[model samples]
Target: MKRAGPWLRVVAGSASFALPTILGIVILNFLFLQLLPGDAVDVLAMRSGSATVESISALRVQTGLDQPLSGQLAAYLSRLAHFDLGVSTQYHLPVADIIAARLPDTLLLVGGALGLAVVLGLLLGSVMASLAGRWIDRMLSGLLMLIYSTPGFWIGLMMILLFSVKLGLFPSAGSATIGTRLSGLAALYDKAAHLIMPMTALSLFYTAVYARLVRATMIDVLRQDFILAARAKGLHPVTLIRRHAIRNALIPVVTVAGIHLGNLLGGAVVVETVFGWPGMGRLAFDALLSRDFPVLLGVLLLSSILVVAVNALADVLLGWLDPRILTE
Candidate 1:
């Protein structure tokens, strides 16, 4: 029963977030779409086989384009309530189908990228903490600042130019080709090779962040009375740091890591655009360009849901890991 405490809280928190999260997504999508230079009507017209004001207007109403904002919103909610996100008028395909087919690709990319980022971040963070105020520590600090300041897309561009364009070492873009063979070991290596640049960019960027976080947390945890007591017991420096310091420091790191994962999912627009990786970020971008409202909304909804869900889970973990938080 005690072990179930955190999960039960997570479920409740996720449930509470549902309505607001949905409303926020609706409003966000609506506001952005409304603010665009043209609505779905004009967008559809541009891509139509035969384009004209009358043709556009007719198609608009056919796609609920004639409704008032309130009516359109009501219809949107009704359709969404029924799990019918409506077809992408532009793609002429169901939104669910597109998300289903593309979401795994996104999770694969983001998850791999995030895992690499965390490992690098933790290691560098430990090194930073170990060095503290020395020149190496200062250098690492400066490196973190540089990484934090640099944009992911810019790094991605540099990588592509150097590795793909200049050295001719790898493919310039895309996840994989239809004819690409995938057996067992060969397939694994092939995928890993493809992932190298993007993963490295993400890893380097987040390493700075994670290292900073780990450094801060480790410094704080090292100062704790328990850590002091462990040290007094003649604990080896490495064992003391790993078994006591790092383990405790991980609480805060876990929070940042969860939030970072959430951000990566939402924040991949630039990286995805650069790589043409075909994740939700790139899909959402394509939807926005073509005013594929259903696809855009679906992606938006997925991102919002993932962020809220992961954050809630992180909160629960935090609460459980540090009982003082819950007690207070």
Candidate 2:
């Protein structure tokens, strides 16, 4: 049989990084739970009815809340080994089920927002690069900065105020209206309308970063010797850029784009909350307020995995861009 290959090495590296993150997160979370000046037991008892100290003690035991840090961590790892993330103490539901229910909406919101940002940003960036230091470039650069500095929630709020409240253009909040009549396409339309504000807020923030990066890269490429040589050979500007500049310039952007995925995911938190979009961010917000341990752990784990995956994808892309880039 052939020896285990580079794929195994990749898996091992990913696992090595992920394990420490998991340990650190679990420890910090445990400490926070312990140090927080609140009585979860009393809260649970009050909420569940038939309030009693004994019942609260029993509930604490069930949640492993009575255990020491080491013991609780062992139990957490033991359950994690079998892919059991446990139940949410607050919700009386399986943590995985709750995450599964919410993940698609979260993915949809982030994916749509990112897709729009990258496409528009790249196009506008190319235009700005072509225009160089002209008025068009200056105007776009200023606009991009303004968009970048604006907080996503604030932008979302302004959009809602203008588009939903003043102009009556889009739905103010939620994924869809509760009682609005709808057929197949009409239902899709309503959902899209609901997505408009949050998506726009997200896209606008990311666009400036992308545009600036692309413009700088193109400018750098324009100064290269090969580009000048191609121009001297009487090549069309389009042909010179397409044949030499864009190909080389894009390699760096690929890595940058992959790294930006993490930023996009982080930004989704505020955007989701602002628009009342049903996503992991909203779930995480609620979990934090309720101190729902299981759900919180699951979200942290999932987000860490995604961030790592994007970085690994970037490494793979670097290899694609230039085969000389090597890692074991």
Candidate 3:
């Protein structure tokens, strides 16, 4: 209980800090969306065959867009205080409802990709570190560099072309089949099939990054005095690597992974579009194209929260991994 007190304080501090940051993000997102050239009314006018100036003006007033910027910001902040994300001008539905409908697919995609990246990267990195300067290391280093340099969307498209178009082994785009209702394992299988291509595309670059990071950290840790001391104690090779080198090396990897969470989510925009996956990224894309400020703002707000939460989780993990961090 005594030890738990400090952790509780840390969590409380993190949440307190995050609240203001989230507010700032909301304000900034709102302002930026306002700065964009057109609004929902303009889009509506363009779409309507006989939309007059009066109709556009009336629509703006009805949508509360006629309010002053300060008033709009105030109202938005008030809505936020009450956890209301507002109604989407494009879909005419609550932003929260739209996001809730799409969030799960995103979670599944990003979560699966992250898990695969971590496992593959750790294993590959360990192998590379163990065989540093060898032919295999050089080959893998080159390959991963190539993968890391390539664009995720391009990879996604190519995968779709090869696997979906040519080989016909997997679905090219989407989270699941359109209409078929399958129960039990059949449904799971269908989802997995749809998931494979997008997950691979999303994970590829991250896998390379983690692999490189882990390899470098492991190599550095292996050269440390403590590692050398452990080696001199006649510890078995695998045990020394596992208990000393990998453990210490994992700290930086965890930090990088957490920091890159936002990037992964951002990249999902392209991957989701390329694969037609109906996730938050795709929703955000559509919202942007339609100038659905409410939906866009909601997505931005949720994304910011997710990033903050991940970073906080990373900090907690760091403190747990290295207790000295807690004191700091």
Candidate 4:
């Protein structure tokens, strides 16, 4: 019970900090979106073939664009207080509804990419650490460096060219095969096929980073006094690494993963756009091009929340892994 008290305090402190930060982000996002030139009315007017000045003015009035910025902001805040994300100016649908439709796709893509990167990273990093300063380690290091240096979008394009265009093994773009309906395992298989290229592209660079981080950290951990003492006790090499080196080395990796959770989510924007996936990233791209403030704001708010939640989770995990953090 005494040990749990510190954990509770840490959680409480994190929540208290996160709530105000999220509110600030919400306000800033709204203001920045408003500052962008052109409003929904102007976009509508441009799209309409024969929109007259009077028609545009009437549209502005209808959409409440004629209202002062303060009034619009007040109305927006009120709606937000009611858990309303407002209507999308471009789609004419509720912002929440639009997000609900696309959120799962983005989650799937990001989650899959992160999982793949972590798994591959830990495995390769362990191997590299075990072979430190050997030819295998040097070669693997070079390969990882190359992957780290390459841009994710370029990797995606190259993968698409090789796997989709040249060999026709996986889909080049999209979440599912168009005009084809499948259910059960078949449906899952098709989705996985579509996921391959984008997921690979998204995961590769992060995997390289994690591998390098883990390798370096593990090597450092292996040199620690505890590790040396354990070695002097005649502990098996594999058991020593498994029980001690990996555990301590993982702390930094966990921190890195948490810090980069937002980056991974943001990177989905590029990957989704490239693959024509019907996810939040692609939705955001469309919203930006169309100056759809409602959708953009919704995405920003959700993204901020996700990032905060991830960071909070990391904090809790760190506290659990090393109770010393709870004191801090």
The per-residue C-alpha lDDT of model 2 at residue 236 equals: 89
After TM-score superposition, what is the CA distance of residue 253 in candidate 2 from its true location, in Å? 3.6
Ranking by lDDT: 3, 4, 1, 2
Model 3 residue 318 CA deviation (Å) reads 0.9
Model 3 lDDT per residue over 1-328, tens place? 9888778877988899998998888888899888889988898888887999898999999889999999999999899889999999988999999999999999899888988898888889988998999999999999999999998988988898899999999998788899999989999999999999999999999999989988999999889898889889899878987877777777887888888888889999999999999999999988888888889999999999999998889888888878877776
Could you give candidate 2's per-residue lDDT for residues 177-249 as a string of tens digits? Answer: 8988897998899889998788889888777877787788888888888788888989988777667666565
The digit string of per-residue lDDT tens for model 1 on 10-56 reads 66776788768768777777666766777667776766657987887
* Number of colliding residue pairs in model 4: 0
CA deviation > 4 Å runs, candidate 4: none
TM-score of each: 0.90, 0.86, 0.96, 0.96
Which candidate would rank higher by lDDT, 3 or 4? 3
Q: Who is ahead in TM-score, 2 or 3? A: 3
> Backbone clash tally for model 1?
0
- Give the lowest summed-lDDT range of ten residues in model 1: 319-328
* Residues 216-281, model 4: lDDT tens digits: 988888889998999999999899888888777678777888888789988999999888888998
- Model 4 residue 29 lDDT? 89
For model 3, the superposed segments whose C-alpha errors exceed 4 Å read none
**CA lDDT scores, all candidates in order:** 0.79, 0.78, 0.90, 0.89
For model 1, how big is the CA root-mean-square deviation? Answer: 2.3
